[model samples]
Target: MGGDHTISYPILQAISGFRVVGAEECWHKSLTPLMKEVREQMGDGPVYISFDIDAIDPGFCPGTGTPEMGGLTPIQALEIVRGCRGLNIVGCDVVEVSPPYDFEGTTALQGAHLLFEMLCVLPGVQYSR
Candidate 1:
């Protein structure tokens, strides 16, 4: 539930099981509160992060298939990931990065950066670089 303004019907149907927090909702509220709700829902279980590059604004990440405007900035994205700190993150992934559409590889770099951010929030992972 990141930056999907024009979500298709099929995709909507597919994500019915997820608790979607829309882009507007994210903009209007702080991520900490939303993440608190998520934590309550998740209850003490291991978490998995599936980060879509398209969640970021095209201005920051132009390599995704469906680049949407008014999306999260890189800093905002990192903060959202950071909000997962103290959770039991067992695994994570970053997806929907199209290198062919990237400008000077900025999007790919951002994807990597996001991955790093996720790793930083994991329970016991130690990263340096």
Candidate 2:
């Protein structure tokens, strides 16, 4: 969920078992389309999820190295992680949280929560409220 998005390219390549493709930034009100496309492509295969905190709006995730405007909201970020509920998520991570810049701890809190969300969705995890 954090760190350099470019790193995804190399990681995808290293896996060799999946498609090694570049990622395109998505700016929209909904992520369903993008998620659907990805889910279809994955087709029940084991997948690793990585979320960059920079994907959240700087107002919400200012601690990230690459803060961008018009990024996802904290709510949207949670939904994205939670949306993986039925997928074969082998493992996941949230990255790019720089606390030195997060004076109010908003970004760090969100990053930690997203990481927990990732864990909840992993295959065989017994999710609970």
Candidate 3:
């Protein structure tokens, strides 16, 4: 978690005029603690959540390079994203999807579906190609 935030800090710092703080492990049992800390440190800025489905439990989404056990469910993940309502979501991406690893196509399918769900939660403003 710290590594991810460390890598993301510089880019966010460049785009926004504030320093990015807090390193929350998305797969942790309680997401609220991490989220609260981020909110406290960052203070309600536009938040773009990059969800790597691999972070979810393999049973829930068995398609990714590294599948962790006991990760959040799809619904839980979606809720986390939705919970950040009212914050500006500039953009998002769900990466690390190696289709070869997903024998049943469940992972890729869910990945695409979740992308649509995320779009729905985004600002109503239209996007151009």
Which candidate wins on TM-score?
1
For model 1, how does the per-residue alpha-carbon lDDT over 37-75 read when each residue is reduced to its tens digit? 777776666576778889888988999888999888787
Estimated TM-score per prediction? 0.77, 0.75, 0.65
Candidate 1 segments whose C-alpha is farther than 4 A from its true place: 1-17, 126-129
Model 3 lDDT-worst window of ten: 1-10
**How many residue pairs clash (N, CA or C atoms closer than 3 angstroms) in each of the candidate models, in the order given?**
0, 10, 0
Candidate with better TM-score, 2 vs 3: 2
Cα-based lDDT at residue 53, candidate 1: 88
Candidate with the greatest lDDT versus the true structure: 1
Which regions of candidate 3 fall more than 4 Å away from where they truly are? 1-44, 125-129
The digit string of per-residue lDDT tens for model 3 on 4-113 reads 23346534743544443222444435555555554565555666667778766789778788887767777666665655454566766676667788899888877787
lDDT of 2 by residue, 89-119 (tens): 7667777888789899999988898898888
What TM-score does model 2 achieve against the real structure? 0.75
TM-score comparison, 1 vs 2, better candidate? 1
Clashes of 3: 0
Worst 10 residues of 2 by lDDT: 14-23
Better of 2 and 3 by lDDT: 2
Please give the TM-score that candidate 3 achieves against the real structure. Answer: 0.65
Pairs with steric clashes in candidate 1: none
